[model samples]
Each structure stands twice: as C-alpha cells, then as structure tokens.
Target: MERKGESRGKTPRAPVTERDSSRSPKRASGLSREVVVSATAVKTANPLAEEFDLSASKSHGQEPLPVSFSSPPLLDGLRESVLQALGQSASPTPIQALSLKHLFSDIPEWRQYLLASETGSGKSIAYLLPMFHHLKKSELALPEPTSSTISSRSQRAVNPRALVLAPTHELSRQLSSFAKALLHNIKLRVLCASRANVKSTPRATFTASKMAAQFTDDADGTLGMPHLGVSRPVDVLVGTPNKLLEMARGRRWDRVKDETDKQLAAELSGSRSETSSKSPEPEMGLQNVEWVIVDEADILFDPDFQESTRTLLADVAAARGQPVPYTPDLLRSSPETSTTSTLTQNTPINYPFNLILTTATIPPSLATYLDVHHPTLTRLASPKLHRLPSTMKTEYEGWTGGNKDADIERRIRKVWAEDSIRSDFNGKRSKILIFCNKGTKVQSLGAFLEGKGIPNVALTKDSGARNFGNNHHLDGFLRTTNYKPKPKSSSLSEDKEPHVMITTSMLSRGLDFSPDVRHVFIADEPRNMVDFLHRAGRSARAGQAGKVVVFGKLKGRGSAKATEMKKKVGALRK
Candidate 1:
C-alpha cells in the first residue's frame, strides 16, 4: 500500500509538442478521421459571456449582435412543465445558455456535444434538458398503449434509453437527484444502481402482475427487483460504471438461492431478447440506449477505471450486435472467452448511442482519448472554463516559515488566527473547508485540529476513521454551524457549526457545499492545476464571497502551475 506522500515510478512518456489552433489534433492510437471542434478562447465585456451566435452576424457589420438575458423566454428549448419545476432556480447558467440549441435541435449535424466547464457551471442541466426533451418527445410520439404494437414496445422490460455514468457513488447520487427533480411530472422512472440491487421510487403506475413478474425476494426476504417492469420502462439510469454494467447484464438482481426467485430473475432477464422456442432469451443490457453520457471524464480516464471503462463502452456498442468502430485487441483478448466472444462478433454496424462527455478539467490524456474515441465531439466551453469567478479572492501562503509537515500546520494556524478571517466570521462559527492530498492526511489533520480544541470533522472514506460514525461528536460539530435539523427530528436551537471540515479531493469536483462556506484552506499541495481550481471552487458558489489560502512553495513544480493558475484567473477577472 502506498502512503500519502509515496510515489509510484512514473511510466516513460513520449515528448510533448505544441500544436497550432489552425491544425487538427493528431490521429494516434486507432483514431479515425472525424469532425473535430477544439476549444477557442473568446472574451467579452460582460462577466457571463454571450451565447454562441451562429446567424452570420447580421451582415458582419451590425455591431456583432448584442446578446441579452431577458424574461418572456427565461430559457429556450425547455417545455413549460420543466420550466415550472425549475421554479426560482430556472435561470440558465453560462454553460446551459450556449448548449441548449444543440441539445434539443433535431439537426443531423448537431448530435454529439462535449462540455468543458468549471464546477458549479450547471453541466448537469445542459445534458439533462436535452435528454428529458428527447424522452418527452419519444413518450408523446409513441402511439397509445392500447395498440398491440405500442403495448409490445412498452411491455418489453425497462431498457433505459438514456444512461448516465458517473465516477463516484456520491456523484452518481447527486446526478440522479437533479434528474428526478427535472423529470417532476414527466411519466418517466429514474433508476440508480446500488450494490446487489437497483433503486427507484416507482413514479409510474404498474400492475401487480407486471411488478411480480420482474422481481423476487432474496434470501433476506427483501425484493431484489429490476428497475423497470412490463407496465413501465425506465427512462433514465444513473449509476457508477461497475454497477451500471451489472444491471445492464441482469446479474445484480440474481437470487438463485431461492427457487422461485431464480425463475423470476431468469424470466425478467430473458424478456429483452428471444432466441428460439427451446432457448431462453438473452439479457442484453443497454440494447436500446439512445444517449450515453459519461460525467467527470478525467476521472474515468484514471488507471484504475481504464479497463472496465473500455469494456463497458464496448459492451454498449455491441449490445445490439452492432459492429464496434474501434474495438481494440485488449477487449478481444480477455481470458474470459464467453464475454470476449460476445463483444467482438458483429452482425452489422448499428450505432444507436450518441456520447456526451463533460469535465471541469480536460487533462492532456483525456484530450487525446477524445481525439480517438469521440472524434466528432462538438466542444463547447464556458468563457470562464479554466478560471476562478470574480467573487473568489486567492491568497498564496508559501511554506516560507518551515519546510516540514509541522511547518505546514503552523502556517495554517497562523492564517486562521488572522483578524481578517475573524472579521469575516464576526463571532459566528467559521464555515471553513480544508482540503488534503490523501484520505489519511484528512483524518490525521482533522484529529489534530480537534485535539487543539478546534472542533472539526473529517469526511474522507472510512478507514480507521471514527468521527463520521454515529455519535455525539458529530452532533456537537454540527451545532457549531448553521445546519438545520430535518423535519420531525430532535428539536434543538441548531445554531452550532464545525470550526473546520477536513476532507480529501473527493469533494473537489461536482458536490455542492453549503452556501455559508466563506473560506477554504489547502493543507497539502494539489497535484495539478485542475485540482487547485476545483478546491478553490467549493466556496464562493451561488454568487457568494469566499477566500482560498494555499500553503505551499510557489516554486519548482508549484511555480509553473501557479503561473497557469494566475493566467486563468486573470482572464475571468476581466
């Protein structure tokens, strides 16, 4: 096991070369020729840059067509029902405003979109509005279920037409919640893949026979049910890659220990595809997926998830016996003959799924992968994609005082002791978020702070951790903040809040923090420019004032990274 600061030997990599904007990206590693739209830097006088205007610019001389945000049409492309559900939070973020046209349009040329924007820029809504719009259109266009043709289509168990893959369990849940809110009254069921089971709050009405046909009680007597039934089809499935695959292949709900349960599982699984009179139908997951979206693209490209990620993509492509465009030998050479044989054999090239990949930071590796896998990915980026918002102020606190871990802690202590932070707090419990490089450091630093009488909590993954467990300590820590108790829970004044929260980079990407967060501290130096930006982004969200202090030397590796950080921040500060 590698320690917090330990390093695995770096793999030798090819030398890097600078490319010009006029030239297309290199087609390396099985990359084929396809439409490529690279990111272009644009500036505007307004804080939120104007939406992309493709109307030939009013004869190229009429002042470039001023863009405005007005009311009668608060947002375009969304139906009135969706707009009503959004309520007061209906205004489009910068990312949403630019992408909505392509999202809902049926144009043949505008199917795939790649979003690279900052955290909290509303990337979820960008893809979701289009997805829901498509689903709604499909729902409306289908003939009434009274018709035998329509009934057959509806009765064929719930094969999700829209699938969303997230990197972490938390991110998957967060994305699913947003989707459910937007889907408010739409006759669609959202499914989340959990360990050994699928979760869905049955929004669509289903007959008892149909429900019983699709599920069976496990050994624990709890129903291990599939997300969809004959009466209702799942419109959206949001889950991590592994769990999503398990549901797609019909293995997550298998309860062979119970004879009745075994038969029910087989019946539900075989309903997707019928082979012969004697042979049962095969369970082809994702056979009907029309839209497959991968969120947090950079994390999915990590070494740990690379192989499973590739296999999942291959399976989706081959779900309907379609010819995969770029099937690598790694996918075909697997020792598991059953899986490999099914994935490689092709009947015809039927590409039913369009891919949408989004991330706050696009590393070079990810950019290269896009060049190969999603050659036609239409790149749309926020003007502030790589920069901090104007409301966020950054302070560079170098390790000038000392060079050891103790020195880092002392620097942090000094910053919290500053009168300016106190002034910002004004005798209220300080809403501060501290970030560390690894999980172990998060726990250690959190315990250290608690030992120093600064009440705190650690939110890292469970290891030897203790505070996150059920106890009075967490309650006391919550009292220090403005956390309100849920309805019908124990009644208390609810004024207490923790002085500080120490956590790992897991919270850096897409999770929303409380609006009261006024300050952020980085206890350990981040590995990349993207890490730094996301860490600082946790605060100053929803148009609030926030400050971030970094405790590290702005030299050596930090020097180049800091320079890039400054350049990006300066661009948005304009």
Candidate 2:
C-alpha cells in the first residue's frame, strides 16, 4: 500500500556549495506547546490557580474556538475534520472552495501558478491535498523491506521527496505538525532546516520530486529527534528559506583531531584519561534534494528576498535527480518544480529553473518577468485574488491629524474589553490576531494593554525576548535564539486557543488559522492596497464571519477601498 505521507524532498549532495551569513538554529518548543492548551480550553481557569485549568482543558479538549455563523451550513464532515485537527470548525474559505475542484483530482501539471486566495483563505490545504495524495500513492507502490540497511550507500534514503519553504520557524513548525496530523498512519519523513540543529548522522537519499532532510541540534530534548534507519529516501522537508538554503549549500566542517601531544600535555596537567584517545571520524553534511514548496510565497518571494530564494532554487535544482544537465528548454515553472530559470531581462538565453512560485496576488509585470525566466509557466487564474468572505465587517480608525494613540486605546478597550473578553473566552474564546504597521506601535499598544491590567502579550520582530539569527529577506528573522517571551502566568493553551497575539505581517501567511479568528485589530494605517487587503484577510478566515478593527485617526480615514469591497459583494448578490 502507498504510504499516505511518503517522504517529499530528499536528494544527493551537489558538487557546488555556498554559505549563509546568518547560519544558526532555533528551537520553537517553548511557545508552540502551550498554544494547544490556550486555544482549545474555554477560558477554563481554576479561579485561584495562577495557571490555566488543566482539568478543564482535558474536559473540553475537543471543543473548537467560536466563529460566528449566520446560516445552517452544509459542510458536516469537513467541519468535524477541521475541528478535530485544528480545534476550530467553519466552512471552507473562498480559496478552499475554488481549490476543492482542483484538489479532488490528480492534476500534477497544474501545481504552478497556484495563487488562489489571500492570508486567511486556507491555501495551505489547497496544495497539501494533492501532495498527500501523491505521496500516499508513491508509498503504496514500493515493496515492504525487512531491514533498513542501505543496499546502496549512495541510495540509502527512501520515501522523503518533498520540500516546503515557509518564512518563519513558527510557521514551519505549524505546517509540519499539521501535515503530520493529516498523514497519520502513513510512512513519511518530515524535517526542519534550521542551522541551529546539527544532523549528527546525515543520511544520503536518492529520489525524484522530494526535499532533502535538514536537522538541527537540540539540547533541551523537547522536539523529538527524528531517526532515519534505512539511510532511507526522505519524502518531505519543510523550513524557512534561509535554513533550507544553508542545508542545500552543504558546508563542510574542517574537523582536526587533538594530537597525542595534547594528550601528553593534559596528562602533565594531571587531567588526562585513557578514554580520551579515541580516533575521530571525518565530518559530514546534507545530501540530495528534490521537491520545493515556498509555503508563504508573498513574504519570501518579494524583491528583497530574491537573491537568497534564487540561490536556494539553483542549489536544490542542481542536486535533483534526472533531467540531467542544463538544457535550452528545460527551465520553466511547473508547480512544485525546482528547476532554475534560464533567461533574464534583455537576456534571451538566461539560466533556467523549475521553480514553483505561488501567492494570492501575481501582477502582470511580475508574471512577465517570471515568464522571461520561466517561459513554460502555466499561470493558473482565479476570479478573485482571495477566497475569504467579504461579509466580514471592516473598520478603519486613522491618525493623520493628531495623537492617535489615545483614540486607539479608547477603542481597543471598547472592542477587546478585558472583562467581556475574559467572559467571552470563558463562555467560548476564539483565537485573536492583531496587526500593526511598526514595531514601536506594537510595543506601545502592548504596554498600554499591560498598564490597563489586561493579561495580554505582544510578539514583534525586535522583542528583547527574541534573539534572531538572520533577516533572510523573510518578513521574520531567518533564525531565532533562546530568547522567547518570559512565560506569562497567562499563556496560550490548547483548550483556550491563542485568544490574542499582537503581531505584524509575520503571522499573515505561513500557518493556517481561519474562521476561528473572530477579531482582528490593525493598529496602523495600511501603506497600500496590498497591505490593506493582506491585513483585512486576517479577520474573516475560512467561511466563518468576523470583525476587523483598524486603529487610526478620523482625519485621514479612507473608506474608498472598503466602499469598493461592499459594492463588489453587493454586485455578487445581485
């Protein structure tokens, strides 16, 4: 039988290698674990207990966050599955609906140009369904082996053959867990690509349409270190762009053994031991890679991130199986393809690649540029940029005139009321995502929330609690340090989903948190239409209704866009 989640990305090492500026590892075990309890529990608190109510969480562990629904929905199985996997239930977002038809079939050719919907349209599911089906089918075809010993050292690894490149550690972690949950009872190899963790015994793999395994060193022992027995072909590898790029670069560690002279010196110093004379083996590195998934393409594929993304694309493609050396017509976009492009502006015979790029919005100019490099791209089209509902209310408070901070404070207090929010969470709390334009404003708002004695926290790029590795062109830090939030007496719990997370656009795209997110507070003015829509998409996710709260001053309030949105929805109804 084909394994449900066959390995996605695993390949042999290439001859050429490169290095990254911020090569570091990040551990996401801290905040991620608590999210389950906080998001699932119904604000279940043990009154006098400083921490959350563990018993309450267990009792309602299966309960989902409350998302508004105006009508009797038709999706029963889908809703149950979502709530079981993600702790929330709502109809498929517009993107999910649009992608449903595509997902029901095996259209391996239509993988590229998959920019269907915006931030909260559940695009994660759009691509994942096809990937799961393909992996499962691939697994079923292979014969059951008795042992994991590599018959061929060069072709040791089995299965793993896909790559998912998200923008942040949090998002990558979220995707891995999500896929793992869905592909349960199947053979799959999912790996993360942060330079932080060291792959002690890096296994080599040979496969097609997969990703290379990249491991990180973990001293805390929270994340289970995945063991590869078969020198096995890996199937899926997911990580941020920089970490994957570093793994693909395959840096060689120059290990020099301690000489016997040093042992003699240590003996003279009276601290030598007989066991200190063991021989050391040569250092090793990552191997072949295959499939590639730019999970959140919008953030990582922007102009700023082109260099690293391009470099990663070239390296991963160069190491993939078959299709041999560079050719004239080989370079093109083929959804999930990792080939490099062959041409550039004013340059006809540019480089070629099988790079698959997807996002909610793809401008004509950008499409043209990509066409120059990917002449054979199959640009998929959708009626709208995103499939999220427009019925969600959108409010804008501007500050073009005076001190808008006061106004913002007054409103946040009104909508996200401390007492009512707690009661709402107690009755049924929903995950809340808050967005802001600048880091300073995020800090200011957080401080205000604290000053008001509200139990809340803020997550920004520059939090003193964060030690990021590199900027890596991602909206988030390429890698993070041990610095995380000081464990709050009030942290997100499974039973009580993340009721509120003050953030930037960093949380906009990577992970999937839909209709369940009932409230969104945008504390700053959107710079452009793209920014506005991206921020707006956070409120009403999946098919659940939601409320959007924008913080600004009235003098500069611009509802022109909002008016247009209402008009469009109205036209659709008519």
Residue 479 displacement (Å), model 2? 22
**Tens digit of lDDT per residue, candidate 2, span 242-324?**
66654444322111134455767778989965534332221122233334567656556555565565565655444443232
Model 2 clashes, total count = 91
Model 1 lDDT tens row, 290-340: 787888877776555656565677788787566465444432232223254
Alpha-carbon RMSD, candidate 2: 16.9
Local error of candidate 1 at 341, Å?
20
Question: For each candidate, how many residue pairs have backbone atoms clashing (under 3 Å)?
Answer: 6, 91
- Provide TM-scores for the models: 0.66, 0.59
